[model samples]
Target: MNSAGTWATVTSGISFSQFENVLGVLDVPAMSKNTFLKKEVEVEKVWLKHIDNALVEAGIEERRLAIEKGDVDDGMPFITVIVDGGWSKRSYGHNYTATSGMAVIIAERTGQLLFLGVRNKYCCICDRATKIGMEAKPHLCYKNWDENKPSTAMEQDINVEGFKMSEKMHGVRYKYFVGDGDSSVYAKLVQNVSYGRTIQKLECANHCIKNYTGHLHKLAADKTFPPDSRKLLKQSIPRLTAAARGAIRHCADEGETVDDSISDLKNWPYHVFGEHAQCRNYFCQKVESNENLKIITNAKLLDEITALVSRLEQKAPRLIKNKTSNAAEFYMSLLAKYNCGKRINLGQRGSFQRRCYVAGSERSCLGTKPI
Candidate 1:
């Protein structure tokens, strides 16, 4: 049990379930704990107790910084926060689920996690305790354990509660919320009195790229494009979108105002797709010119690219809140690993919450290592 628990912390949360698997592939019966599966519940109980202790330690660190800075009421000194949610199945083939929401404060200068918050969703049965006329999810009686709130509520109780806790602890709400264009989270922040003031929304660059390329793939499927041209265009989507973003940034750097930068971004595809392309000025050699590209001269494909650019421009910021949700996504992977790789045990709610708390603590210590 001691070895398994230590291994989990050392690996930043590879669960005890992986212990037997690791030993099976290794020659080290020396480190082997054959009882990991049999003693899983006890091991997790020990692990979770430590996680609670770690959270208290992190909060103390926050308070120490606050006292030193003489700004106990000023909130972790962050104007922006990146927020995202993740969900995983509790068991391999079970209806039970685990959902968590996380928020990370980023330093303006260094862009590191100044603070992190994680909250797990709770499932409960609301008999006569259930509110009348409340629309909850089919499986969940309450959205969360708190006040038996309806399960389908917009800002998920866990996520909003996490933010509210941060505000109380740190003393100020983030001025700008960065996320993957999930309006529900944003809407909740906007509606909250603590966070509503001068709140700006930033869509993640990675999500923006994913969304922009979706349209490109749709255009690629049109039969109007020849097979070869379709292949070329499909391959070009990422390159083209990257170049478009670069152009927008370059325009801003060259003293263009936000409106001008957005205007330039909106008109970028039309100006760059032609033989005498203006992309070379900003994106350099990213835009490849091809005689075969003439095959895509169909007005429909051109219009599709135009619309995509317009949509991209609207979502793409002249200065993003954060470059990507890579940190958030990587942290989610870490959470999964703690839950025992791809297979999670949703059987015990407390166990899942312990995993979540441990993952968040480990993430805080990690400080966004390369990737």
Candidate 2:
């Protein structure tokens, strides 16, 4: 029975009905829905316990690394962490109607999950009772979010909760926060989470570059630009993004000071637009190349691209840290696999949370023995 439940939820995000169908095709008797639900409850308990233990161990490792690296304040270890959030439904960068959302904090040193939180805006028992015009029977309610709050706000709330509980859940303080370009989460942490000191925000290099790429693509698609200008902009996006990424890498690895790094990044646009006067020796070798080889020639288009590069320059200091939320992102991808591509509404019950726990456990225990 336990194996059946694990296969249904952990191995594949299939409903009991689908599981029964598979069993029928195999000429095997299927467990009743009630039995499957009971078994799933047991599996949830086990996975939750495993996640708790993994978090505790991860925290211990983080503290040890902090101490070893001399990142201590007044005898308290301080560590850096990467945070990111994911929604159960696909938003495609616009829609935010997901009924459930999840966020995670991963220690930078150990690359293990330290904490995770989920916010669900649905309850199957209550929904069923309301549909039938009857009172909700006593059952495990999964809804925990306020209906009045927008779904997009769930990530900030979950992140704040994780930051606030850091000290109580783990003995160390999150001195540095590495996340995407969203300032709301960091702002909330600064305003709400009391860590006895300020939390420094570090930008994920990939996200910063991705945002720059997105702006260039947006400009290419805009109707304001002429057809030839748009074609040129579209063709230049790959080189532009590559140059941005290379600037970041050079600044992070080669530059001596923050100002130096920022200056190098700021000069990248000029070098790419055929002005190599400010180009560093390592960044550009063909200073003698003709200006006609420049990809961006339109004055207005040059101004727009320069404006975009300036935005990236403002974030150069953060990008120099070279920190990323990739571990958290990998865990979210694992969650999606277990959640089965948003085809099923797992959040309607405890199934969504249970599946999340399974993913957390898998991520936390990666490269180790199975829990």
Task: State the displacement of the C-alpha of residue 199, model 1, in Å, after optimal TM-score superposition.
Answer: 1.8
For 205-245, candidate 2 gives per-residue lDDT tens digits of 88888889999999999887677777877876887788888
Could you tell me the TM-score of candidate 1? 0.68
RMSD to true structure for each model, in Å: 7.3, 2.6
Candidate 1, 237: how far from true, in Å? Answer: 2.0
Candidate 1 RMSD computed on C-alpha atoms after optimal superposition onto the true structure: 7.3
lDDT of 2: 0.80
Q: Under the 3 Å rule for N, CA and C atoms, how many clashes does model 2 have?
A: 0
Query: How well is each residue in 1-371 modelled by candidate 1, as lDDT tens digits?
Result: 45455446435555544554665578645333344433444555665566456545555455455456654334344344566655545334343334433344443222344444444455433333355656544542222344233223413443466556655654444556567766776677657646565567777767876777777888888886667767767767766777666655565457565565566666555444544353445444454565644655653466667777777667656243325566667667777777666465442334455565566666756653676
lDDT of 2 at 153: 86
Candidate 1: lDDT over CA atoms? 0.55
Task: Name the regions of candidate 2 deviating beyond 4 angstroms.
Answer: 2-5, 130-134, 291-295, 367-371
